[model samples]
Target chain A: DTAVSQTPKYLVTQMGNDKSIKCEQNLGHDTMYWYKQDSKKFLKIMFSYNNKELIINETVPNRFSPKSPDKAHLNLHINSLELGDSAVYFCASSPTQRGNTGELFFGEGSRLTVL
Target chain B: DQQVKQNSPSLSVQEGRISILNCDYTNSMFDYFLWYKKYPAEGPTFLISISSIKDKNEDGRFTVFLNKSAKHLSLHIVPSQPGDSAVYFCAFGNEKLTFGTGTRLTIIP
Candidate 1:
């Protein structure tokens, strides 16, 4: 069984279109995060949620929004996507900060291509 | 500004040799650093990590050495095998985690 899973492994959409990527983790972790890996291969943190509370939001465009329905799920929704938004999005989960090893269990990234 | 930087985009090493991948960071406040490995079409996996209080951490054939004064850290894989070929990323954790662009390590037979 996959620890962390994201839907729509590959997506190709037109600019200005709206899309959402759903992520779920069965690891019983308290913290979940979204990360973007651009063309340069740099992994940038977009947002983080701990037990359904928003935390660690980076400076990203307002078009990108993250929703956490529970501690085991975090979903990313993009409105009016642009070409610059084409990248691989990764969903990760980890144990809470205290007594944690800082190890992030990541999902096989969802690749988004905006044309 | 890129806080974490992996200057070498790619590196090639002969099999059974030591493969060293380097990373540098501008932030001295990062409390912990980690090395992650990734293969094509896969998410990066945690390889090893070291804390700001320690200079080195080793696990099996993989070792991570951190030099806080120089703001640099490196991952060394001794006697590298073909399966060890992958893109390596170094990340620093403070309030949040910041990652470098990553260095692709190629092990040639």
Candidate 2:
């Protein structure tokens, strides 16, 4: 069983379209996060949720929103997707919020391409 | 601005040699550092980590060295094997982890 899993391993959609990527963790982690890695392979945290509560919201655009129905799941929904949004989106989970004992476990990643 | 920086894009080392990957961070609030190894099309796997309280942590052939005073960290792999070839990313944990751009290491056989 996968500790962290994501849906839509690959997605291709036209610009202005709306899509969503779902993530779930089986590790019983209390905190989950979303990260975006651009074509240049630069990774940045977009958002974070602790026990279904929004914790950290980076400088991400308003078009992107993260929803956590439960501690085990976090989904990202993008509205009016743009070409700049074409990148690999990764979901991660940790037991605590930046605690010394916590280490983030990442999913396989969702590759999103906006044409 | 990027908080964590891996200046080297790639590195090549002969098998059985030592491979050293370096990373620097501008944020002083980051008290925990970790190294991850990622293969193509797969999620990153934890390699090693070191807290600011400690200067070094070792696991098998992998060792992470932290220099808090210099705001720098390095991962050293001794007797590098071909299986060690992968992209290595450095991460600093505060409220969230900030990762470097990643450095691809190739171990030549």
Per-candidate DockQ values are 0.66, 0.69
Give me the candidate number with maximum DockQ.
2
Over the stretch A62-91, how does candidate 1's per-residue lDDT look in tens digits?
899999999999999999999999999999
CAPRI rating of model 1: medium
- TM-score between candidate 2 and the true structure: 0.97
Judged by DockQ cut-offs, the docking class of candidate 2 is: medium
lDDT per residue as tens, model 1, B29-67: 877899999999999999898988999999999999999
Candidates in order have lDDT scores of 0.92, 0.93
Q: Would you list the clashing residue pairs of candidate 1?
A: none
lDDT, residue B12, candidate 1: 97
Q: For model 2 chain B, where is the 10-residue window of minimal lDDT?
A: B90-99
Report the lDDT tens digits of candidate 2 across residue range B1-109.
8888999999999999999999999988777899999999988887888888899999999999999889999999998999999999999886788899999999999
The total number of steric clashes, by the backbone 3 Å criterion, in model 1 comes to: 0
